[model samples]
Target: MSESYRVVEPQTGVRIGFGDVWQRRELLGMLFQRQIAARYRQMLLGVVWLALEPMAQLAMLTIVFGFLLRVDTGGYPYPLFAFSAMTGWWLFSKTLMSVAGSLQDNIGLISKVYFPRLILPLAATMKELFDGGVMVVILVGLSMLYGYLPTAKIVVLVPLFAYAALIGLGVGLWIATVMVRFRDVRPMMGLVLQAGMYATPIVYPATLVPERFAYAYQFNPMYWVVELSRWALMDKPVDIAPPFFWSLGFVCVTVYGGLMVFAKTEKIVVDVQ
Candidate 1:
């Protein structure tokens, strides 16, 4: 057998090369598999929980908002309406939480090994994408049950899902890098996610938001994802206005900055861990 070597370069200023992560795709795949296994290892239903967890959330939201509050979903069934948005929301929330905690969660492997630290968050994002994909499948079935078959608009969901992942990964990277030192960040993100869910129109219609505050709401990245997703899946009316472009621009800035912060601090932060 031939010996292989990986050159160790002294750390410099912030530099981001995703190509380094791509070259080690095998390691990325391995890490993804390990995360899937560990996540479901102790669970009774295992992979079933992926479907069950989202469905359970859907049921509760339907009861509270649909039955009791009587939130108007433009005559569309509330279960389908809420769930259509839930699919994307679930992807964003899970990816953010998973990627934010990834490095700290794998402290054992990270401390002992020299693989690309970026792979940890990438792997966590992949696992959540898998989980989100399951929710999408269920969404399609749920849509059919409501007598609304998918249209050409369904194709839009692919890019929309990608947009959600970028948003989550962008924010998560910053949180993960900081979490190496400040343990409070994890719980802080938990609270943010809680508030964010309500702030986004997940349980209610965007029409419910007063017209005065609507413009400001459009700047929210989650608002764009959730609203556009509703348009794609439920035929809900959504305008591709200037604010939509602004939200996309926001995502681009966030992901780039997050990558920089993570890359710059990765070496030093691992030491803290």
Candidate 2:
């Protein structure tokens, strides 16, 4: 009698791994729909909550940063200036949290499934597209109200959205792989996000950082995203300097590295969970 053995290998090539994801695009779409349904199944306001949540947050931010601290906004209306950055930041932060928790949240299904593990995070990312679309409308409306009418530069937001998602997915993939072994990493990420918001120039302008420390601040990936977003949305100034290039290189390294790490460890995650 002769027997044959089956072998499975890690997806080491970024292109190969993503190609697998593409091949399973239908499964990805199904998961995206399931996620959306599950999220709003019983909520009273349903998808409208997506719009409400940000507006409520913007109101509080306007009071705290715009009123209490009286942060300078470089002559633009504070709401427009802050919301422009907030739109991108929200996409990044929510994607990170959603993707990071995806594997754990669906551990039961993951234990039984033989699909591309990347699908869960990618599905989680889909809802953010809806949320982002809503935010963009609000942003445009706010911009016009503030006399910062739409410009051709606004088109840059298309890639900027993808850039923000890439950053989140990169970091989330690393965390998702780790959290299967160390659940503590999940909560730690929340603290990191909270701290990260203050570190990035969102509610406050970049100028608030003293000129001496400006170079170091450029190390922040979102700093580039926010500045570029403001420039695109409101014609604010942006410096595409050495630091911007460094952060861009760092982001590229991060996303590719995260994919490699996730592919290496994905099989083991089920065993640990």
Candidate 3:
């Protein structure tokens, strides 16, 4: 008599693995929809809030930097200069802030689910993208209002925006993973964002950053992304090579580290809940 051996098959449903995430794309879409709906639900201004927030910031910066500090905007109106930078910075900061708390806030689902934890942070990013689209409309209006219509260089914005989003996603993933283990990360992130607004070349042009510190300032990826937005929209000359490479390297390191950390700690995520 021949002995028979049993073969075990790996589980096939959605799980933490990368291949599983690709298979569960529908679930990611659903999560994105849920985030958008929740963000706008029961709000009087709804989507208008997106435009208003940036507009208010632009107005304030125009007054403080343009009128008070007497900053030069490369001859473009201060509102245009400030709005362009705010467009990219707002997307990065808002996406990072929302995603950092996603894991803890969605613990109820994480404990019960077999989906990729990365999905939570990624879905939060989509909400920022939706708001960013609204900001683009406002930008177009402001461009025409200031008589600074974009030239063919505006076509560069597509790739620049993609770079901006990837930077946010990579950093958001890293922060979200860390926040799960260190609850203090969230508040520290708020402080970082506040400091970043001042450190970045948002309210003023890169020319005003002083020649000696320009190299050091390039270490901040948002500085490049913000400059890219202004260059794309305003046709200004920008040093894209250094920051672009730095952003690419930073994204790779942060995303890989985030995924590994998340995979290792996810096993205990439910226990903490």
Candidate 4:
């Protein structure tokens, strides 16, 4: 077998090459599979939980905001509207929740093996995509049931899903770096993500946010993803173009910074872990 001398194990320094990561692409696939198996291993329903859990959450939200509170979702059916937005929100929240401990969770592998550390967190996202696809299938079925036939614009969900993953990875990288030393970060982010769900326009419409906070609310990266996704899936009336571009800019900055922080601190975290 040919060996690469330049690529060192336990990647050191600030330098991380995309080529090196690509060379180990098989490792990413393997790790991602392991993550999927492990995630649903002990649960009674196994992989089915991935699909059910999101549906269950959507049901509860639909009850609270859709019925009791009677939140306005325009003329669009609340369940369909909420589910479309929640799909992206779920991606952002779920990926970040797992990735917060991606490295620390794999301490055994990290200690013994030399692979791209970036793969750990990126791999965390793969399982989410699988689970998210399950939710999307449900969404598509529901849209048809509601007589909101998907148009050619439905293809736009591809990029919107990617945007969600980037947001998750970016926030996850920063959280994972701190988590190596501060164990509390993992649980704390869980609570934060829980709160972030309601904070976004998922449970309610953007009109509910009063004029003053609306500007600041748009800064939430997932907000744009949810809005864009709603527009793509259901033709929901949301101002796009600008938020789409701004969200892209925000995610680019976040993912780049997250990767940098993770790369720079990878060694120190292993030492600390």
Candidate 5:
């Protein structure tokens, strides 16, 4: 006689295991679509805000850093230099903030849902990725207007964008997991983001860093993000070899650790007061 084995699904709220997310993929897609629609549904400007936000922020940086601080950018125009760097920085920053606040933002749903908790963070990230694409279109137009013709170097942005996503999501997942237990994390992340803007070379050129502090600076993952972004779009110099490996190692650790921690805490998140 022949026998057939039937597999049983694992209980939800136990752990955010591999099988759990895969089974709930449909719900994730539904949530993603809902977020996109909700973002532009009531607003008068709608999607245009995505394009305007980056340009406005860039203009502010141009006035403050380029003209006020007089941060040198070799020969490339300040607008172009800042735009290229901001592209990567905004992606990381926006995604991190969205994902970090995912849990708190979806309290009503979280209290009632039985799905893998990871979907909230993933959906929040998708929203930012869509917003980032809008900014990229503006970037191309600005590049042409500045008389900086696009070159084959622009191809490198693909990997840099993906690298930024990984780092952003990786860090976000960690924060989201921790925030579920300690509500204080929400306020602390604001301070971190505020400080992170100055810590990175978004408005200024990486060349501005002194030789004495160069070694310590490389430890910052975003340092490579801005460097590679400029190298790709603005024809600026960057030491790609080291940053490539450093970012990859950092991504692996952050993502893996974040997932493991989330899996452990997933069952208890909704119960937290």
Candidate 6:
């Protein structure tokens, strides 16, 4: 009798394949919940911190841009202008900060587990989404308080938010991957984000960028994100064509490029540790 022969496939050492990530979906949910709870864990004010930060920033921006800087957000009230931009900016900044150090901070889990590395940054994104919901409620309340009624244009906020999330995720993925290799990226990211707050039209109107520099200025993706948010909430007229194309282009390049870099680096992540 002939002996039976069997062949076994070799393991690739790629710990985070697509199926592995899907299998761990429940872990993602738990991480999301933990992030929310951890954020307000020891704070006396608890979840109120979410509303307070944006509200305070809105007030400050309104005063500085409306009164001191004399920047016009079309005919919309400055508070509304600032608040709308703040809505998007808050989400972007929060997501960036949360994901930047996620890989490094969770090195223990990464080494111990065989789940997708992308989950770390993704969990950070989900936490931002939860925080963003609180901001939306605050924005609605402020609109009512200021007597600005919502119109059909409010529907635009959906897509505008989706675009913002893509920007945040793309940037976060890039930064998170880099921070894993170079810890210095985190502090430098903080400085860049701070400068970005002013560079972006968060507190000011996009028109303030002189016509001569307009083309060069659009390189900052946040410019379009902020502009779109204002247009959605304030019913302000915007040349959506140019900025929309710019944002779409940015999303494509960053997400693709970031993923490539992340995929390559993730394999060697354990070696670096």
User: Against the true structure, what is each candidate's TM-score?
Assistant: 0.94, 0.92, 0.88, 0.91, 0.90, 0.88
Total residue pair clashes for candidate 4: 0
**Best to worst by lDDT, what's the order?**
1, 2, 4, 5, 3, 6
Better of 2 and 6 by TM-score: 2
lDDT of 1 by residue, 1-273 (tens): 699897778887677878889899999998889877877897868778778877888899999999999999889999998998888888998899998998888888888888778998999999988888778888889998998889999898888998898899999998988888899987788788989998998899888999999999888888888888888877888887788889889889989999999998788865786
Against the true structure, candidate 3 has what lDDT? 0.77
Candidate 3 lDDT tens digits, 1-273: 699796656434333478867778898899988877877886867878767777787778888999999898878788888888888888878887877777888998998877777777778877777777788778867887888787887777666666666677777767776777788888789898889888998887777788999888888888887887777777768765665687678777876776676666666677765
Model 5: per-residue Cα lDDT at residue 181:
81
Give every collision pair in model 2. Answer: none
Q: What are the per-residue Cα lDDT tens digits for candidate 5 across 49-134?
A: 76777788889989987899888889788888889888888899889988888878988898896777888888888888878778
Which residue pairs show backbone clashes in model 4?
none
Alpha carbon lDDT at 169, candidate 5: 89
**Model 4 regions more than 4 Å off:** 1-12, 38-44, 241-244
Give the poorly placed runs of model 6, Cα more than 4 Å off. 1-18
lDDT at position 199, candidate 6: 88
Tens digits of per-residue lDDT for model 2 on 125-146?
8877767777888888989998
Instruction: Quote the RMSD, in angstroms, for model 2.
Output: 3.1
RMSD of 3: 4.3
TM-score for model 4? 0.91
lDDT (Cα, 0-100) at 34 in candidate 6: 87
Backbone collisions counted per model: 0, 0, 0, 0, 0, 0
Better of 4 and 5 by TM-score: 4
**Residue 150 Cα positional deviation in candidate 1, in Å, after optimal superposition:** 1.3
Which residue pairs overlap in candidate 6's backbone? none
The top-ranked prediction according to TM-score is: 1
Spell out the clash pairs found in candidate 3: none
Per-residue lDDT value at 193 in model 5: 81
